[model samples]
Target chain A: MAATYELIYWPGAPGRGEHIRLALEEAGASYSDTARLDAQKCADIVWAQMSDNNLGDKNTSPPYAPPILKDGDLLISQTPNILMYLGQRLGLVPSTPEENDIYKINALVLTALDGLSNEVHDCHHPIAKELYYEEQKTEALRRSKEFIKTRLPKFLAYFEKVLKGEASGNGPWLYGGTFTYADLVLFQICLFQPQTDSQNLASSVYRKRDGVREKS
Target chain B: MAATYELIYWPGAPGRGEHIRLALEEAGASYSDTARLDAQKCADIVWAQMSDNNLGDKNTSPPYAPPILKDGDLLISQTPNILMYLGQRLGLVPSTPEENDIYKINALVLTALDGLSNEVHDCHHPIAKELYYEEQKTEALRRSKEFIKTRLPKFLAYFEKVLKGEASGNGPWLYGGTFTYADLVLFQICLFQPQTDSQNLASSVYRKRDGVREKS
Candidate 1:
C-alpha cells in the first residue's frame, strides 16, 4: 500500500506549497493538504508543528516553517527539498539517478524559486517577514519597482535560455526534454508573476524564447 | 591523481562561495578558486561565465550566477546544489544513498542559508541588489533593525532546538553528530552575523542549547 502524504502549510493563496501540491497532483499521488482543512478542526496543527517551544523538540527533523510534509514517520521541509523527495519517488524526475541528471533538474528548481518566487515575496515584504505588508508599504513599493525592472527580467531571460536550448527540446520544458518536476516548479512560479509584465509576450523578455511566438 | 575542480565566483570577502570552498577544504579535495587570482589574469572569468549573452548558451547547464563550478564537462550552480554534488563525491554527506538522509541534511542547509545568509544580504540591499549601500542606506538601516530584533533570533532559536536535540548528538553538529557540508555552511554564515548577539551566548538564545558552556 502506498503511504498517504500529509502536507503542512499556511492556508491561503498558493505560495511555495503550491509547487509541492502541483508535483503531487501531476504524479497522481495520494496526499492531504493539512492546513487547508477546516479551521475549527485543525487550527493548532501549524502552530504545533512550528511550535515556539523548541526546547521540547527531540524529533530528528523538526521543520522551521511550513510547506513541510510527512511520509509515515519521516518529515521533510524546504520547498526544493520536498519537491526533490517527491520527484525521485513519483516519476517526476528522470529515472536514471546514477547519471546525476537529478541535480541538474534541481538547479533549475532552485533558480526559479529564488529568482521568481522568493524575490517576488521579498518585494511584498521588504522590511520584515514578521510584520504585515501595511507596516512596510514604502520599502515594498521601491523593492517591487526594482524587481520588475531588473531581477524579474534577469530570471526570465535565463529561463528563455533554457527554453531555447537543445536540452529543453525547443518547447515549454526547462530541462533535458523531459517533464521533470522543474517544469512543475516553473509553471507554479509563472502563476504569481506580475501579470502585466508576463502577458505582453511580444514586448517582454520572454519574446526571445523560441515557441512563444508560435504559441501566441 | 585526482581531477581539480574549478570554482567561478567574484573576488570579495567570503560570500556564498565560501560555503562551497569550506566543503571542498574540509573534504581535502583539489580545487581552484577562480576569482581569487590576480586581477588581469582572471578579470574576465566572472563576467564570461555570468555573461548576458543568454541566447548563445546552448549547453546542458548554463549557470545564472557564480559560485558555479565546472567539474569536467558538468557545470552545477546554486549554493545548496553545488554542496550536495561535492558532498556526494567527497564524502561530506552521509554515505547511505538509499536512506534519504541527504535530503534531511539539505533541509538544514537551506534553512541556514535562507534565514541567515540571504537575510543579511537583504539587510544591506533592501531596495535593489544592484544599487550601492549608500543609495539605500535609510531603508537598509530600518531592515537591519528588524532583522536583529526578529529574524536572527527566530533562526538562532531554531538552531538552538537542533543543538539541544538528540539528533544533533547533544552538541554543535547539525545532524547525526556527523560533520557534513551543512556544518561548513553554518560556519560561513556565522562570519557575517551581527557580532554582539552571537558573542553574548550566555544571555541569548544559545543559552537554551545544552553544550555551549562546556565548550566555551
Candidate 2:
C-alpha cells in the first residue's frame, strides 16, 4: 500500500511550518497535519516512534522537530529538504541541469528566509528563549535595528537580483518563468511584522530609495 | 571562455564555508579560495563586485555571502544548494527517483547541520553579537545546556536511524555504500566540542537504554 503523506507541525505559531504547508498545498498532494499545542506533545510522538528501534521500516525516521512529512513508512524532515522532495515529485523544480540551477537559486533564497526568521525570533528573545522578552528589551531593540538596517536589505537585494536575473524576463516571482516554493517563502518573510516603527520605516525607505520594491 | 570556480570565504573561520570546501575537495574539482583576514577586508571585495552602479559584467550573478561557487557562467550560493548541485554533477547522487529519495534524506541531514551550527553560534552570543558575550553569560549558559541535553540527541538519533535504515546494509555512512556530503557535514558537526563530549556519553547510555524502548 502507498503511504499517505502526513505532515506534523505546531498548530498555533505559523513559523517555519508554513513553508511545508505551502509546498504541500501548492502541490495539491494528499497529506495529514498533526499540529499539537506545545513542543512536549510533539516531542513525545517523535520520541515514541524513535523508541521503536526498528531499522527496516521504510517510514520510521525520527524527526528532530515539527514540520516533518511522513509517507507511509518513510519519514522526512527539514523544510528545504521537504520542499525539494515535493518540488521534484510535483514537477515544481526544473528538469534540465540549467533549469535545476534556477531551482537551486530559488531554494537558496528560501534558506535565507530561515535566516530572517531566526533574526525575527531573536528580536523578542534576544538573550534566550529561557529568559523572557521583557527581560531583554534593550538588547532586542539593538538587534532588531541591526537586522532591519543590514541583514534585511542584503537578503531582499539578493532576491531582487534573482528576480532581475531571470532569463524569462517576467514580473514577480524569483524564477520569473515559474512559481516555485521560493516565492511562497519570500512572500511570507517579507510579510512578517517588523519589531519597531523605525525598523519598518528603514525597510520601506530602503525599498523606495533603491527603486526596486515589493508591495506589502 | 569557461568561468573557473572561485570560492570566497573568511580565511580563519572554517565554519559554514568548510562544507563547500569539503564537497569540492571530495569531488576533486578545480577551484580557488579567496579569503581575507577580517570582515572589513571581506566586505570590501564582496561589495566591490556587488556594487550595483558598477555593473561591469551583467552576465555574472552576485552572491550575497561567502562559500559562493561559480561554475562556468553560473554563480551559486547557500551551502546545501551548492552541495546538491555538486552532488548531481559529480555523480554522488543517485540517478533514479528511488535513489534520489535517499539523496533527499541525506540533504535533509545536511540542512540539520546548518541548523545545529546556528545553535552553536547562539551559545557563544546568545544576546545578539552586538552585545558582548560577557553581558549575556547567563543566557548563553542556559541555551548551551538545553542544546547539549535536547537538540544534540534528537539530531544524532535521526541520523543513526538513517544509517541503520540503509537498504544495502551499509556501514557508518548515512546512505548506501558511499560517503555523501551528508556524511561530511555530520562528521563535522559531531566533532564540535560539546557534541563530542555528549556523544560519548550518549553511546554508552543509549547502548543500555535501546532494548527496553517501544514504538510510538
Candidate 3:
C-alpha cells in the first residue's frame, strides 16, 4: 500500500514495528509496510539502513536498529520514540504543551514494551540476541516458566488495573476515557494470543475489551 | 537536599535512578535522593509503592517498577519516560512543541538506555531480574563476553558517529553544539567504567570528551 509515512522494517514478525503499524492503522495514516518485497530483500533493506555510511546527518541521529519511521525531513527510530512522535501528530495522544497525559501514556507504553516484549524476548534468547532459539532452548524453557509465573501476570494485572482505574471510566481503555496508542499497544502485543497459561486472567481482561474494538 | 521534585527509588546501587540524578545534577534541579532514610525503610518504601493497592488512581497509573519521579501531582516511572518528562521541564531538551529535537534527543536517550543500560543489565541477570547475580554468574559471564565483543563496540561506535555528526559540531555532545541530558546520560552510564575491552575504541571516545567536563 502507498503511504505518506514510509516504515522501514523487516517484513516479518517484527513485533516492535507491529506496535507502530497498530498506531498507524488506528490513525488511518499512510505508511507502506514493505509487504510487497520478498523476505531476503526485506532483510537486506533493514541491514542497509543500519550501514555506518548512511548513518544520519547533522540533524538526524543514526538509528541503531530497525522499525524506523520516516516523515519528510524527519527520520525517527526507537519504538516508544516513534510512537511518541506519531502519538503527538496523529491524535492517538493529546498534543498540547501543558498536558501531562502524553507522558503518562508513554510511561504505560514503555512498561509494556519492557515487561511484555523485551523480557519475553530475552526468555527465548536468554544468553544472546544473535543466537538462535534452539541454541538457548534449555535456558529458554526455564526462563519461560519463570516468566509465566511472575512477569506475565504482573504486567497483565497492571494493565488490568489501569483499565479499572477511575480515569479509565467504565472499561477497556488504558488511559482516561479515550483510546490512545497505549491501548493499541497493549492489544497488539500482550493481549493477542497472550503468552500465558492462566486462562482466567486472560479471559477477565478480554471481557473488559468488549467495550472497545480489538484487532488481531 | 530539599527540592521541588521527589525521587522515590531504593537507595543503593540504583544505577537507573542515577540516570535521573545525572540529569538533575546537570540541570541543577532540586530533588532529594532518599539517602537520609535507613536502608530497611528504603526497601520497604520501594515495595510499598509497587503494591497493587497503591498502583495509581484516576489520573495516575501505578508504576510497575521504580526510579519513579514525582512532580507535584504528576507521577512518572520508566527511566526514559522520566528522562523525557524531566528533559522538557528542565532545560535538558528543547521545550518548544513545534521543534522535533525533543523526539530526536529522546530517541538517542532511549537507545542508550536499551543498549547501554538494559542490555548490560541482562548480561548479569540473563535468566531473571529477581535471580541473584551469583546464581546467574555463568550465564552472566557468557553474556558479558558477547556484549564486550559485539554490543559494546557497536553502540559506542554509533555514539562516536553521533558526536562526529556535523550537527554535533566537532565536539563531544551527542546532539547539536549543546550539552544536553544526552551527553550527561552517556557520561553517567556507558563512560563511567564502559564495560568494554576495546581500549582503543574507549580511549578515542574518551579523548573527545576532554572538551567537556566528565564526572564519575
Candidate 4:
C-alpha cells in the first residue's frame, strides 16, 4: 500500500517535524518517515530536492530546506504550509470555506511556528545556523533567558487566553471546540522542558487538555 | 466609500507590511494604513486587539502582533496568510484550483518571508526582540556576517533559479507567467540595500523583470 504522506527532515531530532507528526497521528494518516528509515539517504534526497537540478518537473519551486512532505506528485515544504495542506486533506481543518475557522486556526499555527519554534531554535543558534551552538552559547544564554523570561510566557499566555476565549467554545483548543493542528503544534512546543514557573504552569494546562494529551 | 482593506502595522518602518503593501499596489487595491493616520492611537488599537478583550466578536482569533488586516468583519494576520487572502480576492493569483499555481506561489512567498525577512530581523535582534539593537550589536554583527555571506546568497540563488525555472515562463515572476504576490514580496525584499554580490545580482534581475517593474 502507498503511503499517505512522506515526511523528510533531519534525523534524530523532532524539531519542526514533530508538528507534522502530531497532525498525522491525530488524523490517523498512514505515513513514512524518510529520515528514520535511512538518515544518510534522506539527507541526500533533501539536498537534491533543494538543488537547482531536482529530479523532475514535479515542483515549480524547490524548497529552501527540509521538513518537506511528499504526497504522490506533490512535494512541498514550509511547516505552516505543509500543515495547512495536510490539515485540510486529513479533516484536521473545517471543510467549509464559510466556516472561516480554518483561516484563524492557520494564523494561530503560523504564530506557533514563527514565534515559538523559530525563536526556540534561535536560542541555540543565536548568531547563525551554520555556527555551532557551542560557539554561540554565550549569545544563546542571553537569548534563552529572554525566551524563558519574556517571549515564552508571552506566547504561552496568549495561547492560554485563546483557549479561554469565547471562540474556543470550551477548554484547551485554540479555535472552535475541536482539536486543530494549531493545538497539536502548540502542544509540541510546550513539551520542551519548562524553564520557568510560567512555562511549567503552561505545560500543566497543556497536559490537562484532552485533545492535546490524547496523542502525547 | 469604505476601504477594501485596513492594514495595522507600526509607523515609519515598512518591515513586513511592505510585502502586503506591494501586493496592494500591484492589485490597485484601496487600503488604509492605520499607523499612518495616528501612530499613538493606532498602537493603542493594536494593543487592545491583541489583548483578551478586543473590540468585538468578529475575529475568531486576535493576532499576536500587528501587520493585521481588517476586511469587513474579518480580521487576519500573518503576512503570507493576509497576502494569500488578498491575492485571491484581487485576482493576483490564478483563480482556478486546476491551475495548481497558488500553492507553489504561496510556498515561495513563505520562503521569502521566513528565510529572508525573519533572518534579517534576527540580524538586529540576535539575542532578543525586547533588547535594543545597541544592546545586541556585537551578536548582530556576527549574525549579519552569516546573513550577508551565506544565508542571503542561498535564498537569492534559490529564487534566481526559480525565476529561471520552467514554471517561471520566460522571465521574472515566480509563477504562472505574470506578477504574483510572491513576485511582489520578492521584489520588496530585494529593495533593501544589496549587501552582497548575490543580492546585487538578484536585485538587478528583479529590476529587469517587466511584470515586477511595471508598478514600480
Q: Pick the candidate with the highest TM-score.
A: 4
Ranking by lDDT: 3, 4, 1, 2
Give me candidate 3's TM-score against the actual structure: 0.92
- Quick one: best lDDT, which candidate? 3
lDDT of 3 by residue, A15-99 (tens): 7888888888888898776544898887888888788776477688778887899898788899999998898889987434337
CA deviation > 4 Å runs, candidate 2: A1-4, A27-29, A36-61, A71-74, A91-97, A124-150, A160-170, A192-216, B1-4, B36-44, B49-61, B91-97, B129-142, B157-170, B192-197, B202-216
Off by over 4 Å in 1: A1-3, A54-59, A95-98, A192-216, B1-3, B54-59, B95-98, B192-216
Q: Would you estimate the TM-scores of all the predictions?
A: 0.89, 0.74, 0.92, 0.93
User: Best DockQ goes to which candidate?
Assistant: 3
Tens digit of lDDT per residue, candidate 2, span B40-66?
A: 777576666566543223333455555
Model 4 C-alpha lDDT per residue in residues B1-216, reported as the tens digit of each score? 887899988777888888778788777889988768677887787787787665235346667787888987888888899988888888887655444566677888898887778888889888888889999899899889888887887787777777677666656567766767777787777665544455675753556444466766
- B42-131 in candidate 1: lDDT tens per residue? 558877766756432334656788778779878888999999889889997656543867888899899999998999898999998989
Model 4 misplaced regions, further than 4 Å: A55-59, A95-99, A200-205, A208-211, B55-59, B95-99, B195-205, B208-211
Give the clashing pairs for model 1: none
lDDT of 4 by residue, A38-134 (tens): 7788778777877777523524666777788888778778888888888888988654545556678878888888778888888889888888888
DockQ of each: 0.57, 0.27, 0.66, 0.57
TM-score of 2: 0.74
